[model samples]
Target: MITLLIIAAALVGIIFGVAAILPNDGYGHRPVPRSHVDSYPTHNPFL
Candidate 1:
């Protein structure tokens, strides 16, 4: 019974640790995808 309680506590600790380590935008919004930004051309050969 004690071992089961310890296991459950360890699982909870791991979950909190993982959540803290994850990256987050200041506004709680995910950053735009790389592919979306690449769609707009930054340079033109004729320019």
Candidate 2:
């Protein structure tokens, strides 16, 4: 049981370590491109 627990912990740690080392591109907060800007209306009546 202890060995299984250790293996699980190690796997979790490795996953987090790898994720932490990778580069991020704004994490989904990137700005919209100029080309798609005109698709949405300047003013929305629903809002």
Which regions in candidate 1 have their CA more than 4 angstroms from the true location? 25-47
Tens digits of per-residue lDDT for model 1, 1-47 = 99999888777666544533456322365434542223323321221
Q: What lDDT does candidate 1 reach at residue 43? A: 24
Per-prediction backbone clash count: 0, 0
lDDT of 2: 0.45
Output the number of the TM-score-best candidate: 2
The lDDT leader among the candidates is 1
Candidate 1 local accuracy as lDDT?
A: 0.46
Q: What is candidate 2's CA lDDT for residue 27?
A: 42
- Candidate 2, residue 36: how far the Cα is off, in Å: 30
